[model samples]
Target: MADLSVAFVGKKLRSPIGVASHAVLNEGLSGTEKETEQLKAYSDLGVGFVHTPFICPEEEHPKDAPPGWKFQGIRSREPFMMEGLLVATEARRIMCRLNAGLNMIENLKENLPDDVAVIANMIGPGADPDGWAEHCKSAEEAGADIIEMNVSCPLPASEAKAVQEYSTGEMSEAAGSLLGDSLQLLLPVVKAVVEECSIPVGVKLTPETGFPRIIGFAEGIRNAGAKFISGINAPITVSPPDIYKNGQGKWPGMTTNPICAALGPWDRFLLYRNLGTISLFVPEIELAGIGGLVEPEHVVEAMMLGARVCEFSSGILWKGTDIIKESLEFLETYMDRQGYNSIEEIIGKGVKYIVPVEQVDWRQEDFIATVDDRLCTRCGRCANNICKARTLEENPLRIVIDSRYCIGCGLCQAICPEHAVSIVEQKHPVIGISVDE
Candidate 1:
């Protein structure tokens, strides 16, 4: 049997899989009971941790806002298989009032399994470092095992009407991706929280903070005393308008297109960016993977790339609570099959292999493409579209590969509907050959 528990921020998680912070599903005007019930359901399913939906510092929801239950409204569309999931909503929808959020944390701590942890996902007053610090401290006192500063939510910044109008840049008071992207704003808040709280503190980062720049952001967060970085909050995008409906939005019951948060299978690469870049550049800090992870295999993929724990938000919406159970089972079977005895053995296993492309040895001369005749259906899909290496030989109605011209690029192998093409090693390896030849 494999050990599924993993250490995150000096605490042990029963499993690396946890529920990502997302909109709470509330049944009525008094939303706390339903929220607590939903969380308890996740707890019963054996999640390692659960994040309280993005909690704000205000004691009550803004009076101008709609009811808490209504504010949790979300709209989603799956345009195609490749688009994965596109989720859109006004930022107010996911906000949880401070008193309600703290109570939920207290309730969870009292009732959750001993191995389960509670991460308070907090969004504080952006401009006030002291205020942010105070909010974190309150969650700590309220029994949150960890504090995840959710500074990368997409909806807040996505609400901005025009990007071209501001050469100087626009800042929102909402304190999400805007805070995570700007170091001057983020570092002070992180420092204040670390000073005020005794527990592990982490930042959930924005996907907007892309590579090279992400390196600087990670360095700054680590310097300011954050223990881990979890991401990425869904990236902002507009769903394609319905061409037949006079460019109306695809969201059901809404005619106008609103800038929404994108989720689902497409996010794995962005999640890998956070995992790979931070793991390689900022080894002192930890990572929790959260974006586009929709399947059991994605959990292991995230771990190998240095995610200590992985959370499923959109995945849960797509696959349901069963994703957690499936992931835990998958982890155990995968670890044992791979000869990994513990979760620690899998963490950061792939990081060392991620090198600059310039440093990769292509070794063209040692490999060549080969066609397996036994499996070939003579489809000619590869011969017409693939490369100069393959051509249809008419007599037997088969595709033939000229070894001299074959570069082993594997395009044919990848596109082969019949799985007849393969890249294989050369029996007599040639030395000192340029790729162009």
Candidate 2:
């Protein structure tokens, strides 16, 4: 049998399958009692550390707007619907909506079982490192075992915008302009929190920045005496279509807003890349991989790629909390079957499998797309959506194959709503992969 027990945030966890900070545990203010009960249930089920919200003293709505200013907060007007529900009074609900840290911690102490380790997640602009550090001390006093500094939220809410300047790429330049490049702003508070608290501190990051920048940032945190890293939060931006219909007939279709903070399949790949890069610098640092973990295979894959722990959230939105227990069961079975005795033994086993650029073939040759007209609805959905080659046509409701323009990338086939498109080998002259060798 594999030993799933491992240490994280200065405490030993029963398993690596831990819940990501989410509304489920916080449950707004209205259902604080129920949410605390739920946390206890998760602890009994043998979960690792339980993460809470990116805590701040208060939640303020953005006042001055930028050109594309969208509301950024736990409750945003974005179309990505979260599936959990809460039962709470209007006032308590509003309080929970405002100061997540105060309310969530108070509830955890009042209700959660003593054995369950609580990880308080803090978020704000890096400019307010002292304030964040003070908040960390407060959380530690409130029985928090660890503090997770959130620096990677994608949505530009007031807090996110405040810290946006410190992010990678253009965002970092913006941040430097606002606050100089010393990276000293975060140091004072980080050092203060580490000195004040008995627990370990970890920083969460995103993959949007280049590797060198991430390494530099991590090195800075490590220099400040932080203990671990948890990151690559929701790397890709997904623009899911609006499916709701209003009373005014078909609702006007607004362009799909990039998923503010949600994670999906695309994010998983980015997390893998980021993990690979981080391993190059701090091979021994504990890493908690977050975003887009949907199945047991995703957990195992992340572990193999050098993650010491995996944080999950979105899968529960798509499936349910039951998925947590099911995933753990699956992982335990997998570990047994693989003949591994512990989670650490399998860590980084899959990193070597990541193929370098030299192993990839960039040369393109030939392939063909064949549409089964029988399944064709000719809704023009596929043709209009992604047919960059413009080879697809409409009317009698059939896609006319233009071999000259088609590169056979299968974009049209993939977007076809009717399952009418297929890419098959061309019987004529082989042009691409078939022609080579």
Candidate 3:
């Protein structure tokens, strides 16, 4: 039998899937009763854990601005993309929700057959370390098994002190990614929480840190004493405006351009960038995969890269809570079929093949691309796109390969819309100049 149980951040989880802290969990305005039911529903569905909504120390901020949500469903055949932005207020996280979340945590802990860990999603209290520590402590007191510092939220800062902190890079005074990206500002907060909390501490990272820089960002937070890392939070982005009207296209009516949080499948590669990098470079940091996980297979992919646990936000919003059961079914079946006894066996399996550009030895000569004339629709897509190695023949009016420049990269084979291209073994792998074959 496949054993799906694994230790995440030192806490035992029956399954690696969990509900992420997202907008829908904000039950303060809608009322906590609904949110509690949502938590119970997830626990009942076979999820190993449940993360509470983002709750701040202060219920209301002195400076408050509502970050609105905007979504655009791109029309295409590519993997589904629902690009969006969230310009919402973290300041509005009310005490009512926090109280409700606390109750849900306690109730779920007492009732569930197998203990379902409740992770509290908390925002920083700006520059106040004591206040921030107390906020995390509050979650711990509320029966949270883990406290996740939500430093990576996509919303901007809204308070005077937070705005001043944002001025360093013109970031949001809102304490999400604005605070998470700041090494100086965020480190102190992480240290405070780690020192203050007896429970496991984790930091949710921002995708906006950009690549290369993310390497240092993860290391810094780990050094600050965060027990684990869960990412990637939504990216801060601008919606493309309609050129005709010179205004951004959104619901209700076209409004002036505003920076908003971008979420969905497009962020998958970005998730790998951080998870893989941390797994490869910062081997000690336990990672939780978050972004771009719409389907069940993505959970396997993240674990392959080195994530102990995984969660999905926009996908669950689109697909509903059923994604949890579907994901669990897929993971268990995958484990059994792959002949793995435990989830730990698969984590970081793919990291061995991941190499830096300098270490990559491009095998250039074993093969060359061939055009299958029968399958060829003679679609100009490959010829036009792959100028690097393919050329349109003048006399034969057929596509031919320039082996000298090809390097057998297979771009032409991949770009062919008609599936007419394939790479075949070369009898003699010669030094390339140009063969008009």
Off by over 4 Å in 2: 24-26, 29-31, 59-103, 106-115, 124-126, 157-189, 235-259, 352-356, 359-437
lDDT of each: 0.80, 0.60, 0.75
Please give the distance, in angstroms, between residue 87's alpha carbon in candidate 2 and its true position after superposition: 21
Cα lDDT of candidate 2 equals 0.60
Question: Candidate 3, which segments miss by more than 4 Å at Cα?
Answer: 60-70, 76-96, 157-164, 168-174, 372-375, 392-398, 418-420, 424-437
Looking at model 3, which ten-residue stretch has the lowest summed lDDT? Answer: 79-88
Better of 1 and 2 by lDDT: 1
Q: Against the hidden reference, what TM-scores do the models get? A: 0.90, 0.65, 0.87
- Of the two candidates 2 and 3, the one with more favorable lDDT, higher being better, is 3
Q: All predictions: root-mean-square deviation over Cα? A: 4.4, 8.7, 4.0
Cα miss at 69, model 3 (Å)?
4.1
Instruction: Rank by TM-score, highest first.
Output: 1, 3, 2
Give one digit per residue, the lDDT tens place, for model 3 in 165-260: 676644332367777878887888889989999999999998978888888988998898998999698886666666676565553344655555
Q: Residues 101-142, candidate 1, lDDT per residue (tens digit)?
A: 888899889999878999999988754689899989999999
Cα error, candidate 2, residue 334 (Å): 0.5
